[model samples]
Target: MTAILKTEHLSHRYASTWAIRDINIEIAQSGIVGLLGSNGAGKSTTMNIICGVLNQTEGNVFINGIDLRKNPEEAKKQIGFLPQNPPLYTDLTIDEYLTFCAHLRLIEKNKIRSAVEEAKERCSLGHFSTRLIKNLSGGYRQRVGIAQAIIHKPKLVVMDEPTNGLDPNQLIEARKLIRDIAIEHSVLLSSHILSEINLLCKEIIMIESGRMVFSDSMDAFNNYVQSKAILLRMDNPPAKTEIVKVPGVTQVDVLSEKQYRVYFDGSPEEVTDRLITASVEQGWKIKEIGPDKGLLDDVFKQLSSQSPQ
Candidate 1:
C-alpha cells in the first residue's frame, strides 16, 4: 500500500539541542499509528514538524507524494492537525465555527454547507450546531474541533493527546470517532497515556532522547515480548537454586515469598515439564505459570535501566 505520509531521515533541533534525528517512517493510509513517548520525548516536536507548524532542521516529510519540504502548502492540504488545545472560537456557534474552518481550508463556496453538515454529523455535532462553542461541554467542544478537522475531508489527521482532560464517556466517544476516521484516513495519534494507546492504536512508534527506539505494528510488538520473563504465584516457598539451574531458565527473582518471576526463553514444553517437576519435587505449589512482559512497562523499564542488554 502506498503511504499517505512518509518521512526520510527526519531530524530537528532547537538551537543548540537536538529534538529528533535520523528518523525514517511510513504510515499506511488507513491505520491508527500511536506516537508513544514519555513527556519530553519529542512526540509533539515531531508532530509539529509534520503538520508544518515548525520546520525540520533536516530530512523531509511527504504527504501523498508531495514533499512538505518543497511544497508544504500542497502537502498540508492533505492533513488535518488538532493540537492539545483545539483552536476554537468561544463566541461562535458550532455551525459558524465549522463553516469558518471549511472556508479557511478553501472548500468550494457551494460545497461548504454539505461539507460542514457531513463533518457535524460525523463528529456528533448535529444536535449542538446552533449552540455557542462556549455553551458546550468539554466533550462537545472536542467534537466540534474534530468536526472542524474533517470538514475538508483531509486524508490524514494528526492529533496530540486527543483524550487529554476528557472524562470516561468523552474518551470513549472520542476513541470511537478516531477509529471511525481511521477506516478512511490515516491517524497519527500522540499521547502519553499508554493504556489508551494500547487500546486504540494498531501500531506504535516509541521514541527516547530524540531517537526512535521501537516502531512496529501492535501484533509484532506483542510477538517481541521476550519469553525470558515469567510470572508464577504459589502458596509455598520454592527451591530457587533448582529452578534457576533448569535448562533455559536464566534468572529467578522472588517478587514475594509466594510469587516468583522466572526468566524462561526456551521451548514451552521443555519449560513446563521442568517447572512441573521442580514444583512437585520441592512442594513449590505452583499456581500459575505464564510469559510476562505483556505490558510495555517492564520493557520500558529494562530499556531505561542501566543494565546492559
Candidate 2:
C-alpha cells in the first residue's frame, strides 16, 4: 500500500542555520507513529512542513501519493493537524466552533451538520455542544481541538504533543481517544516524553539536533539497546569482586543490601545462567534476577552518538 505520509530529504532553514536537515519519514495507513525527539530536535519543523503549515527549504512532502508542494489543496484534504497548544476560541460554544471548523474544512453545506455531529460524538463533545469552550476544562477544550482536526475524517492526523499538560486522568483519556481515532485514521503523534512514545506508538522515528537518528518498529528500537545489566536480588549477596569473577561479568552496582545491578559484556542469557549457577554453588541465595532494559536516555545517547555528523 502507498504510505499515508512520506517526506523525501525534508529540510528547512532559518536565516543562516538549518532547522532540520535531510529528514525522511514514511507512515503506514492506520496506526500511531511517534515522532520522538528532545526540545529543539527539528520534530516540530518536520511536522509543520508535512502538514503544510511551513514550506521546507529543501524536500518534498507527499500525502497519500499526492505531492503536497505541487498540489497543496488536494493533498491537504487528506491531512488533519493539532498543534501543541490547541487552537480554540474560548468564547465560542463547542457546536459553534466545530461548525466553523467544518466550514473551514470545506465540507458540503448539506453535510456540515452531520459532520459536526460525528466529530462531536467521536471526541465525546456532544454533551458539551452548547457549552462555551472557556467553560469546559482543559481536557474538554483539547477534545474540541481534536474534534476540529478530524471533523472531515482526514486519512492522516498529525498531533504535536497531544497529551502535553494534561493531568494523569486526562492523559489516560487522551491516549484512549487517540487510539480509537487511529482505528480509522493514521496518526502521527509527536512528543518529547520517552514514556509517552513507548506507550502509544507502533513505530518510532527519532531525531536529534536537527538530524534523523533512528526510525524503525518499536520492538526493533527496544532490542536496539542490548541488555547490558541484570538486576539481581539475593538474601546473602557475595562481594562485588566475587560477582565480577563470573565470565562476561564486567562491573557491579550495589543497589541495596539485598539487590545488585550487575553489568556484563557478553550474552545476557549466558551471564545470567552463570550468575545463577555461581549463586547456587556459593550459597548467595538468589531471590530475584532479571535482565535490565537500559534507560531510554541511554538509548538516545547511543543513537545520537551514532547519528551522521
Candidate 3:
C-alpha cells in the first residue's frame, strides 16, 4: 500500500543555512505516529513542507500516492493541519465557523451542513454549535480547532502540540479525542514531550540538529534507552559509600538527604533486591525504588552521539 505520507530526502534551507537536511519519513498504516524533537530542531519546517504551507528547498513529499509539489491542491485534499496556535474567529459561532471551514475544504454545497454536523459531533462540539467561539473555554475552543481540521474528513491529520496549554482534565479529554480521531484518520502528532509520545504513539520518529536521528516502533525506542540505574527514596537513607559497596554497584548519586540514584552494572532486579535487603538490615526505611529512565536530554545526547556527524 502507498504511504499515507512519505518524504524523500526532505530538506529545506534558509538563505545561508540549512533548516533541515535529507530527512525521510514513511507511514502507511492508520495510527498515531509521533514526531519528536526539541525546539528549533526543524520539526515545524518539515511539517510546513509536508502540509504545503512552505515549499521545500530540495525534496519530494507524496500524500497518499499524489505528488505534493506537482499536484498540491489534489494532494492537500487528503491532508489536514492544526498548528500550535489554532486559527479561530472568536466572533463566529461554532456552527458558523465550522460551516465556513467546510466551504474552505470544498465540501459539496448541499452536503456542507451534514459535514459541519459530523465534525462537530466527532469533536464533541455538537452541543456548542450555536455558542460563540469566544464564549467557550480554551479546551472547547481547541475542540473547535480540531473540528475544522477534520471537517472534510481528510485522510491524514497533522497536529502540532495539540494538548499544549490544556489543563489536566482537558488533556485527558483531548488525548481521548485524538485517539478516537486516529481510529479513522492517520495522525502525525508532534511534541517535544517524551511522556506525551509514549502515551499516544505506537511509532516514533526523532530528529535533532535538523537531521533524522531515530525512527522505529515506540517499544523499540524504549528498549534502546534501557535503564542502567535505579532511583531510591528512603526515610533513613544509607550513605553513598554504603550503596557503592553493594556487589556489582558501579556508582551512587546523592540526589537529596532522602533520595539517591544508584548505578550498577548487574541486572536491576538483582541490585534492587540487594538494596532492599540492605535497607531492612540497616534500618533504612525504603519509600520508593524504581528504574530511572533518565531524562529526555540524556536520550537526545546519547542518540546524537551515535548519529553520523
Highest-lDDT candidate: 2
Reference-based TM-score of each model: 0.79, 0.84, 0.86
Tell me the tens digit of each residue's lDDT in model 1 across 1-309. Answer: 667989998989898999988777798668799998788988999999999999999998999888898998888899999999999999999989988999899999999999999998898888888999999999988888888777888888999999999999998999999999888889999987777888899898877778887888866655555555777787776577867887778888878888888877768667878887878887878888776644566665544442221
| Candidate 3: tens digits of C-alpha lDDT, residues 1-309 | 999999999999999899999999999988999999988888999998999999999999999999999999999999999999999999999999998988899999999999998998999998888999999998999999999999988999999999999999999999999999999999999998888998999999998889999999987887776678889999988778988988878998999889998888968789889999998999889999987755445676688667545
**Which regions of candidate 2 fall more than 4 Å away from where they truly are?**
230-266, 270-294, 307-309
User: Local distance difference test, per candidate?
Assistant: 0.84, 0.91, 0.91
The residue-level lDDT of candidate 2 at 164 comes to 93
Q: Considering summed lDDT, which 10 consecutive residues are worst modelled in model 2?
A: 291-300
Candidate 1 residue pairs in clash (backbone atoms < 3 Å):
228-264
**Residue 182's lDDT in candidate 2:** 95
Query: Model 1 misses residue 97 by how many Å?
Result: 0.4
Task: Give residue 259's error in model 3 in angstroms.
Answer: 10
Clashes of 1: 1
How does residue 204 of candidate 3 score in lDDT?
Answer: 92
Which regions of candidate 3 deviate over 4 angstroms? 231-263, 272-290, 294-296, 305-309
CA shift of 60, model 2, Å: 0.7
